[model samples]
Target: MNTLTINQKNKKNAARIAAFALLIMTIFAGLAFGMIHSNLIVMSDPALTLENLMSQSSKFTIEILAWIVIALMDFVVAVAFFYFFKTTNPQLAKLSAALRILYTLFLSVGIYHLIQIAINLDHTVLSTDIMIHLRSFDVLWSRGLIIFGLHLIVTSLLMFQTYKIPKILSALMLIAGLCYFTVHALYWIAPSIETTTQSIENLLALPMTIGELSFGIWLLVRGSRKPFLNATERFGFNA
Candidate 1:
């Protein structure tokens, strides 16, 4: 095959890898951060939060594994996209992938604190330290997500410029990026209005999910250019 054909094949393979990884990452993230974290940690009541974690230790262990899977998948998707788009815009692709790697590194560091909590769970006297670590995880993860927002913006720009994907996908991603950037900025900068920012995030969460989720589904459903073939003729075994 020619170099161009080889590159096209590589991109297709990378797209499939990225698509599958993205879906897995999203599912684990929803379980880890959305369900488990929300159920365990209550910022308003740290002692109660610790009690919840102690009581639901099994679930918390699953949450930690889920987060590890998410970070791993993030790396997988990052590497895959770097190859997939290197031909189109090498510099942007590298930068985007780098940002995601940075985010994943930050997230991994945050998850380490949870591991620590698991290690020291039996030490009830260390409630203060345990809760502090939990808070650190949230803060550190949120900081990482700010960089993730930038990654999304750059990825969306690439999508917008590329004719192969739909423009609406890019638009949705842009919106998601803006929402993440703005809400988190509000959380750190204007702590007094956290409730307001959370409300905004809840309202805009659909776009955030729809952008990447739809893109993943689109990647799975897309077929390469091929001649039409009847089902029976293609397989040739069944009646």
Candidate 2:
């Protein structure tokens, strides 16, 4: 095979890996959230404490594993895109790649706090636990979500400019990214918004998740040409 063909194959393989990772992580996150939702409905008092909510994750070990896996998957994707962008379009790569890296770092910290929230929920309710450490968990949760929201927006913008993928896909991603921004703003400002907002945001995740999965699958199952191969040919990889 020629060098170009080899590169194409490598990119396809990378896409497959990213798609599988996204699919699995989406499943795990869905299951975990579903359990949390069920618990939320059954519990009395309505204001779920950090500790109480976390307690519902009966399979803490598995949940933790899933979280770690998903975050790592995101990190891998970010790296892959960085390389791809470096080859394809440096300016776009710099923005999305940076956001992905930031998202991964914040997610790592956020997941840690989530686990802490779970353990505490086992012991106490919101009145007691939510206020623990001056609402540190709440702050972390908000910041993490904000960072992630930015990641989605940045990725969506980058994808919009990409050639191989359909523009509609990126458009939806942009919408989802907007949703994240709205929800995060609400979280930061109102801080006591109804659970409905959370539900709404979670719903957006479904599409966003699909977008990522679809992109990955497209790259793997149906090979895509390098978006700007003509341009690359003229400018070379350095471009």
Candidate 3:
């Protein structure tokens, strides 16, 4: 094949890879955040939380595994996004990927705490200590989300610049990123206003959830529908 044809083929393959990565990330993220984390972890009552964890040990294990899977998927999604968008702006794409990696690293630390808690389940650790560990996990995860929000913001900008994705999806992503950042920032900066902050965060969850799910579905379904040449031709490339 000629050089142009070869490059076109490679672009198509990369788009498919990006799409598949989005789908995988979405599945694992849903399990981690919606199903396992929400159902398993009780943030309100520590005693009930401990009881639930012990009683549902199998489910708890699955929850931890889901978190690990999400973290791994985060890395894959980051790389895929970088590859998909680097043609538009290499530096911004790289920065977004770095932010995503940092988010994954932070989440891994929280998961480590969960692992420690699981180990201590069989031990004689104090209930208060267990509560502390659980709380730490929550805090770390929230902090990680803030970084992930930044990643999303940069990704959204890249999406807006790209013709392959819809502009509406880019707008949704921008809203989601802002909500994530604002809500988490409130949680950290003003703990005294948690009741109000939490309510707002819950409300903002709508946009965040919808935006992410839509973005994933769009990538999986329509990511490769258009050729990348149109975009590349409009935006000059190093090559």
Total clashing pairs for each candidate: 0, 5, 0
Per-model C-alpha RMSD: 7.3, 4.4, 2.3
Q: How much is 176 displaced in model 1, in angstroms? A: 1.2
TM-score per candidate: 0.90, 0.72, 0.90
Tens-place lDDT digits, model 1, residues 2-25: 555665677778778988998999
Which is better, 1 or 2, measured by TM-score?
Answer: 1
Q: Tens-digit lDDT track for model 3 on 57-102?
A: 7777887898888788788878877777766678998999999999
Best-to-worst lDDT order: 1, 3, 2
Worst 10 residues of 2 by lDDT: 37-46
Best of the candidates, TM-score = 1
- Ordered by TM-score, highest first, the candidates read 1, 3, 2
RMSD of 1: 7.3
Residue 134 local lDDT, model 3:
79
Q: What is the lDDT of candidate 3?
A: 0.79
In model 1, the Cα lDDT at residue 83 comes to: 80
lDDT of each: 0.80, 0.61, 0.79
- Over 4 Å off in model 1, which ranges? 223-239
